[model samples]
Target: MRIAILGAGSIAYGNAALLASLGHEPVLWSPSGRSAGSLANGEPLVAQGAIEGRFRMDVARSIAEAVGSAEVVLFALPANGHRMAMDAAAPHFKPGQVAIISSHTSFSGLYLARAIAERGLDIPVVVWGTTVTAGRRAGDAAVNVSTVRAKVDMATIPVSAAARGLKICQVLFGERFVERADALAISLSNLNPQNHLGIALCNFTRMEHGETWGQNENNTDSVGRLLEALDAERIAIAEAAGYTVRTIREHYHLSFHVEPGPVGEMARELAARGNGGNGPTSTDTRYVLEDAPFGLYPTVLLGRLTGREAKLHQAGIDIFSALYGRDFAGENDLLGPLGFADMTLAQLKALVRDGWPVEKAA
Candidate 1:
């Protein structure tokens, strides 16, 4: 299948190479144009670690050009870009096109569905809990991946596209998708925000100071216990909502190759073994900026609706907001537009089970 990858980040480059290696035509496009321009002008995309190869992909200068002929559109960028990306690409989306958000968090599919509905288009939006592979940027169009996860959790919006979406993903990437019931369950399945919350709150100073400390090694016993507490809160919300989300322990084992153990000890072991402890080197990283608002705040919102208090999650958001002197929750495009205040818990659940309400205003 022809795939159009919308984004010019590490994840995008890595997946592009993987897809190309799998014999699929993968095209690249970036809203900013810089990343795509760089690749288009002849920056070869090189992959190392788990999947090794150097490949080149067609780069589209505009959203129309990207989705013009592609059967699949994958947003490999961060949660913040989901809204803008969907808006730009929705008009060009074909009737049977499959839309995917690799590592979907922060209700991205609902946001995409809203855009698709506004355009009166029929498209299946697939939400993956995490990317197939994890890696770091070696250069502008190069990525070094250390781990290719055995499987990643996923879900499709409208609940009816589950089978077709899963089949497409398994064919393109590999047979590694663990399908869930709805987007809410997939949202809770993402462990990055909560895990990063623990790391950020405990190691904020280290980030500010630009300390090159080991992220996993620094997760002392105290930090690990705190992480577990936060995970418990997240799991409680999932359980209250009747979805069985993965625990942080299982997350580490699946995503990072760490065995199941106490959160801190497993982290420490990963750090010592040099398997997967690397993280942000500065305070300006996504750990706080992206995760806190896009990831944690929505979680807090869900927790409150479910009558389950995600104290640590809410606390992280509050502390980060105060420290940064910005209302992080206000930054999310989905929440305010979602109009959670006007809707009840049942309505929200129905929306996730179904797709976005066509009558609702964007």
Candidate 2:
């Protein structure tokens, strides 16, 4: 299928490389325009790790042209670019177009639903809990994937369209796709933000002190315990909301080659498997920025509504915000943007069960 990857960062390049290798002609476009320009000019996209392949790409000037004939539009962009990217791509979206937000955090499908409603068009939007684990970037229209995730869990925005979404994903992602219960369930299941929050909270000083510091080895016993506390909060929210979450042990097994072990034990297992325990660990991590807005905020908000208090999760947010001297909650307009700001807890619950236009907005 013809595809368009909307981000030009490392994730974009990496995934684009895989698609190209799989015989899918993927048009590369970025808001920055550099990655697209580079690919369109017959530049070589460099491949480094995992699957190695090189190829040039067709680049488009606008989101419409980028996704003109794409049956599936895959967004490998960061959480920060998610909604804005959707708005930009909405004008180009036509009927039956499947837009997948990989590794999404936040209420992304709801945001997309709002955009689609605003445009008066209905399109299927599938939001994945996270991307397929592979990473890459373009140097000359080729990509480098250092590592790859074994499987990914995803859920559709409206909850009703999950079947259709999974069918399309299967054609492309194959067995990498695991159907989640719903978008809210997927939102909570995502561990990137949660994991990053723990690491960043513990290593903020390292990030502030120097760029060279690595927090890959910072998962101390206490840190592991804190991570468990946060995970328990997440699990509690999921259970209250009527879903069984993927445990930390299960998470470690997938992200790394280990079984369901403790956090610190899993870290050691990852190193033993040669993944090097080198996931994102810095101030620039989305755990605080993107996930907090897209991932954690939703978790916190849902937990409150679900009769669960994510104290450690909340504490992480508080400390991170204070250290940065920025109001993380205020920085994110997720609830407001989703039109849930004034809605009561009961009202939000109904919205999740039913799709948009839930009531006559007063």
Candidate 3:
């Protein structure tokens, strides 16, 4: 399969290498046109850690060129960039192509599906609860590929396309996808927001100080307790919404290949085995910026809709806002545009499951 990956960051590079390893052709497009410049100039993309290889991939300078000949189009960027990428690629996406959001956040999958629907195209948007590969860029054209998750929760819009989306993902990545009831279920299934909230709140000082620290090593008993508490709130919201999502312990165990245990213990175990990666070194890190608005804020919204109070999640957003001197909740560009704030619970559920412009009878 020829895959078009839109984003030239660590995730994009990591996925490109993974696809190349699987004997598939990948074309990369960096929105800024800078990240993929070296790769486009004939430099080989080097991937280390979990996926180790030197692979060559074509780099497309424009969105149309990238999605034009590809069977699969993957969005491998941050949540903040999803709208821009979708706006650029939606018109070019034809009927036969399948779109995969590496990790869905802030209901961005629904935003993309709506855009495609407006163009009269029925492209299956596969929304993953989390990314397939977790890693960071090591160099201009190199990525330290972290663990490719053992299991990833996924779902497709239009409800009826679930099976085809699963098969498409398995063919491109592997047999690691577990389909959920709907995009709403997958949205609630994302554990990053709650987990990251606990991690960032307890270690904000360390991050601001720019000290190099072990992410898992710092998951101390106190931090673990906080994480568990946050998880409880998230699970409560999920249950109220009538969906069952994974626990933090299960997330760590599955993503890092560790035994299921207490969240902090799992972190320590991962660090003991040399799999725990370093924590963020700067205040601009995604742990707070991306996850706060796109990850945490959405959980708060869901809590409101389901009549469950995500107090801790809301607190995280508030504190982060004060510390960063910006309104993280207001930072989500997709929510307002999609009119999520005015949506009723029933309408929101139908939209996610059935795609945009909900059926009149539904």
Local accuracy of candidate 2 as per-residue lDDT tens digits, 9-99: 7777777777777777887788776655666777766576777666667777788888776877888888778867887887787777888
* Residue-level lDDT tens digits of model 3 in 1-362: 99999999988998999999999999999998878777889999989999998998899979999999899999999998999999999889888989999899999998899888887777889999998998889988899987888899999987889999999999999999999999888888898877888888889889989998988899888899999999898899999988888888888777788899888788888888877688888899888889999999989998999999999999999999999999999989999988899998899888877886523221
Candidate 1, residue 299: CA error in Å?
0.7
RMSD of each: 1.8, 2.6, 1.8
In lDDT terms, which candidate is top? 3
Against the hidden reference, what TM-scores do the models get?
0.95, 0.90, 0.97
Candidate 2, which ten residues in sequence have the lowest lDDT sum?
A: 353-362
lDDT of 2 at 84: 75
Error at 237, model 3, angstroms: 0.7
Segments in model 2 whose C-alpha atoms lie over 4 Å from true places: 134-144, 211-216, 276-282, 344-354, 357-362
Q: What is the C-alpha lDDT of each candidate?
A: 0.84, 0.72, 0.89
Q: Is candidate 1 or candidate 3 better by TM-score?
A: 3
**Highest TM-score model number:** 3
What global local distance difference test value does model 1 have? 0.84
Model 1, 274-349: lDDT tens digits are: 7664667788887888888899998988888899988888889999999999998888887776676576778887
Which has the better TM-score: candidate 2, or candidate 3? 3
